[model samples]
Target: MNTINTHFRLSYQIQDEAFKLSQAGNCNLYVAISSRAMRLAVADVERNKFVALEDYELITVFTPLQIAEQLRLIADQSPILQEQRWLDVRISVSNQFFTLVPETLFDPTHQEDYLRLHSNLDPQQHVILYNRTFGLDAVNIFAIDGVIYRMAQSVFPERTVQFTHQTSSLIKSVLHQTDRNAGRVMHLFVERNYVTVLVVDENGLQFCNVFHYLSPEDFIYFVIFVMQEQKMNPEQETITAWGDITPDSSLFNMLKKYIRQVKFGKRPADVGYSYKFDDLFDHRYFELFSLHFCE
Candidate 1:
């Protein structure tokens, strides 16, 4: 019963159990029944199909005897898998024993040599680089067209020229990996203790912010300051706060009022204006701005 096109290794005994599980309809649940044993079964109810074993692009099932027979089969029968075996390909950090080639054919020392050879050939499409100190953590958020996409965490102690240069290089790598080169308006939220950064474009939004402070006002102020410093037009940008705080939380209530005050009336004389505590906490009084304003 071979339906999925992913490839990986499993013992003959486990493969027998997977075949039974696949037939039992348990494969549709997307649950792993056992971790100690290497087994995978995927059953798509919509398609009424099942695959007892999978890797990334190879899937097949054979009886315990057949599996053993295939282990001795020449590598030509599994062309793509054979190439992956020669290259010492690994799907992920886990599943170390899972290899494209049979265990008998594996050379432990050669694996490292092959990996080094291919490492430079297949550089990551995107790279993110940033530096941080031991005590403080920074969160980076990226959004495109009002939708959130990715978040990253970094630690920063002091601002050094080398650190700044490294961060710039990392940003370039990320952009290259994502294949996005268009101008993107980015925002940085820096509080006394931590910093949050946002990157936004037309596609959607991605948020990365740390939870160092409990107050939402601190987060909002940081966002506003970043926008102003970057010279982004307030009218053209959208800011969505993300973290442990929810939209209906008290902090969000204050933010709604703050946004209104900033956008609607004359700029206040006080750099950081204070609103009545009662008014700030009134959830009914705060209406979420519509998409026309945010989008």
Candidate 2:
């Protein structure tokens, strides 16, 4: 439950006093939850404005019970949790699940069976099932797990919130942002223990997979392996990186050594953010910000 990374800020710190005094009834709160951390961003929805309000990363833990307890404690202390209007929450699970089923046969009743066929673990430990309703009765549904779901619901009303795998938001944002004329696009959302690689062309998603890493080499290997297996040429394809990455992180340097375009992504252009969050890295917290458009 100890804090591994903590950075929480409010409007008055970054906004002019006049702006802070007048921010009522105009905002929406968005949260992105994962095993390693939790991030909160508040946006004045009517104005398309946003500011990342806080970030909390948990210290190393040995068990799921510890992880869940730590996550709840972090939520218990956030003042934003007390404000319940216009909330959108996304829970990220590391389960690498993808199923191709037709819409006619896609019954919500079969959710557990589909995931169970692919994963050999206790469903009691992970009880969340989320899918994309925006696509053509298409194949490839996602299943997310862990304490993030329960923690999210525990803090906010389940009826008023939207839930999906983190990749749903990541893929949604990247597809809209990627330039189709450019041919191929590769996006990497790097986190502490996981790296999600999403690849696409003008046609649509050519590949999507998440890899867990124990070292810098493992990270680079997955990057190269996907590009290789997908027949994407690193020399020609554009790779737009985002998420918890920084200019100095070894993940950045490792990608630079092998690829041509390992640049960071721009914040969603459709959303306006307060100058209060200017101190943050522009490329980070993208999924949390893009959750503004989830509904």
**Candidate 1 global Cα RMSD:** 22.1
lDDT per residue as tens, model 1, 104-186: 44454454333343233222322222222111132211111100001000110111112111122222222222323444555
Best model per TM-score: 2
Estimate every model's Cα lDDT from 0 to 1. 0.28, 0.68
lDDT of 2 by residue, 168-224 (tens): 677778777788777877889888878889887888666777788998899999999
Candidate maximizing lDDT? 2
All models, RMSD in angstroms: 22.1, 4.0
What's the number of clashes in each of the models?
Answer: 30, 0
By TM-score, how accurate is candidate 1?
0.25
| TM-score of model 2 (CA atoms) | 0.84
Error of 1 at 130 (Å): 7.4
- What's the TM-score of each model vs. the native? 0.25, 0.84
The residue ranges of model 1 lying beyond 4 angstroms of the native Cα positions read: 1-195, 200-214, 260-295
